[model samples]
Target: MPNIQVSALAPSTQVIRFNRPHARNALSLALLQETATALHAAQNDDSVRVVVLTGDDKAFCAGADIKEMSNTGIPMWGQSERLLAWKTLENFPKPLIAAVEGYALGGGCEMTLLCDIVIAGQNARFGLPEVKIGAFPGDGGTQRLPRAIGKSRAMWMIMTGSLIDGPKACDWGLATEITPAGGALARACEIAQTIGDMSPIAVRMIKEEVLMTYTKSLDESLSLERKLLLWQTHDHNEGIAAFLEKRRPVFSGR
Candidate 1:
């Protein structure tokens, strides 16, 4: 089997699984490259409506593959590769969800944080433990972690390298959902399917609006919403008709 497994869960959903269980699904250069390739492919494929990133077996990811880094000698190349991988996930146009189980530490946690949504197994653990190894998370960790879990918590996690489990992650809004053991992927897929069932154009617009609002003041967000809300005019009639008739809304994606 390949180090990374990419498979379709539905006509509109793609699941990419990290297969390096022996290494706790660490982000080796090859694995990061493969993951980026998969994300790139999904971005261009109209058939794919949602993408779920996960790992096989017990561990979600144990961070960078130390063995590969040790062999490479030049750390900058590996660092750059992982950074690219993080950027790919962060900017993926379509909805991305991380289905996390076991450990999601260091680079793993960074990867999960980049996704639009995250579903974690009840036993899943998360942290940025690079400090323990005489380094810090370089792959968008300082930026993404604070955005997700707030500056204080992100700083504490990075500085101490302490792990927090699923419930706490949910409490901090770092995780979208927490499921029973072996249920992270399933729950993630359910959310993906719900998203896939919606109108793609509207879905895309909503994502755009939310991202824009993240940096904008409340007044600016409201002002921008005026422009985007007009998109509803394209399909509002069909949506209402379909809802009243008790049928599926066949969006034209206008």
Candidate 2:
């Protein structure tokens, strides 16, 4: 079977599942390549409006496959293909949500940071335990974790190599919500459906603008938002008219 499985949850929502359950869905090079391929395919498929990334009940992902790394003697971060795969996720224009259960450590935690939203199960455990193994998170964990959960908490996780439960993750702002064990994927899919029902143009633009806020100055961010607001497409007009007419608006993604 494929290490990664891509399936349609709804007409507009696509799910990418990490299928290496025995290894706790570790991020091997093959899995990364497959994930990138699935993501690119979803990006180009007009029928797919939102993407949900998840793994099986046992684990979201344990992190990079240490055995593979030791055997190959290769660094994932320095590898061009792996870096490109991550970049593909970073540049994806559509909405991306992470459905996290069990372990999300090191590279696994970094993967969640790439998503626009994170829904974690009650059994989830998040950490950057690379330090314990004499390594550190090289896959956006150092940068994104600080931005998401603030400097102190991110520093604590990185330095201590300690794990936090799902509730604490939600409190720390790492997770948007916490569900019962094994419910994260369902919750994420539900949210994805709602997002898919909205204007695709607006959704994409909103995601772009939100991510842009991380690096842009306040004035620059506002300027960009204003520009997007003015570039309102047919969907925007339809939305306004639909509100006025008290009817559902059909968006063509124009």
Candidate 3:
């Protein structure tokens, strides 16, 4: 069987599941490669408006495949195929939602950080345990975690290698919502469908502007938003017309 599973929740919402349940869906180089390919395919598919990334009910992901790393070692920074694959995942333009069931540790947690929305099960466990293994999160954990949950909390989690459960994750801002132990995927799909129903141009613009606000100066971000105003898009006019007509708007990607 393939390391990952891709299915459609709806015509516009895609579901990508990590399938390696035996190893708790630990990310191997092969799995990472497969993920990049899947994400790239989704990005280029005009029909795919949203993606919900998930794993089995037992585990979201345990982290990098430790067994593989034991034999081949962790991929080093810069100019590595592994890094390139990660960049592909990071650069996905559409909304990426994470439906986390169980453990989301180390690289797994970092994956959640990459997502625009994270729906975690009540029992889901999140951590960066590399410090316990005499290493640190080699992925974007150091950078993204702090940005997601704030600096001191990230520092405590990383330095102590402690795990935070679902409720804590939500309170810490690491998770957008908390669901029943096995219900994260379903909830995520619902959210994805809601996003899918909106105008694609507006959704993309909102996502881009929000992400940029975190990295760019306030003036630059505001200027960019002004330049990419939704009023300039056909979908915006359609939305207004639909509202006045008391009917649904049919938004074209244009």
Candidate 4:
């Protein structure tokens, strides 16, 4: 079987599963390329409204494939593919959810942090132990972790090479929710479905607006919001009308 598997959980939600249990679903170069390809496809497909990332066996991911790294000496092409995966996850317009269980370490943790939301199983453990190996988190972990979990916590994780359990991860804001054992994937899919049921244009706009907070000026931000809502499409009108009627809005995604 392929190292990665893709399936549709619902008409509007796609699930990507890492299947290399022997390596603890480590981020091998092949896995990185496939993940980027999958994300690119899902981003372009209107049918795929939400993307859920999960893994087989007990590990969400064990970070880089150490054996491969030891043999290949970190090929430049491999590094580029990995970076592409990181960017794809980080910039994905649709909702991205990580269902993390077992261990999410180093690059694994970086991958989870890129998701718009993270749901962890009770047994999940997260860390960035790059320093232990005389390296640093190069796959955007240094930049994104501080933004997600704050400077102090990210510093502690990176500097000490310490790992945090699921509960601590949630408390530190690294994970949005914590579920019972083996429930992370289910919860992620549920969250995805909830988001998928919303108006597609509004969902995309919301993502755009949230991403703008990091770099855009106040004027530019406000202008984009105004411009996005000015579409005045049938779906936009339906959203307003449903809100006025005081009932759940059924979005046709026009």
| The best candidate in terms of TM-score | 2
Give the whole-model CA lDDT for all candidates, comma-separated: 0.85, 0.93, 0.90, 0.86
Predicted candidate 3 versus true structure: per-residue lDDT over 1-254, tens digit per residue = 89999999776999999999999999888888899999999999999999999998878999988776643444443327789889987888899999999999888899999999999999899999999988899889999999888999999999999999999999999999999999998899999999998999889888888999678999999988888873587899899999999999999977
Please rank every candidate by TM-score, starting with the best.
2, 3, 4, 1
Residue 97 lDDT in candidate 1: 90
The TM-score, computed over Cα atoms with residue i paired to residue i, of candidate 3 is: 0.95
Clashes of each: 0, 0, 0, 0
**Per-residue CA lDDT of candidate 1, range 1-254, in tens?**
57799998866899999999988998888888899999999989888888999996478889977666554456643466667776787788888899999999878898887788999999999998989978888777888888888999988988999999999999998898899978999889999999988877777777877887568898998898897776555567788999899999876656
Model 3 collision count: 0
Per-residue alpha-carbon lDDT of model 4 for 1-254, expressed as tens digits?
68799999776999999989988998887888788899999988988999999985489999988666644565432466666767777778888899999999988898887788899999999999989878888787899899988999889999999999999999989999899989999899999999999988778878889889777998999898889767776778888898999988878777
Candidate 3 colliding pairs:
none
Predicted candidate 2 versus true structure: per-residue lDDT over 1-254, tens digit per residue: 89998999777999999999999999998999999999999989989999999998879999999877744666767889899999998899999999999999889999999999999999999999999989889999989999999999999999999999999999999999999999999999999999999999889888889988888998999998988778958999999999999999999899
Model 1 — which ten-residue stretch has the worst lDDT? 69-78
Off by over 4 Å in 4: 70-78, 245-248
Over 4 Å off in model 1, which ranges? 70-81, 232-235
Superposition-based RMSD of candidate 3 using all C-alpha atoms, in angstroms? 1.6
Worst 10 residues of 3 by lDDT: 70-79
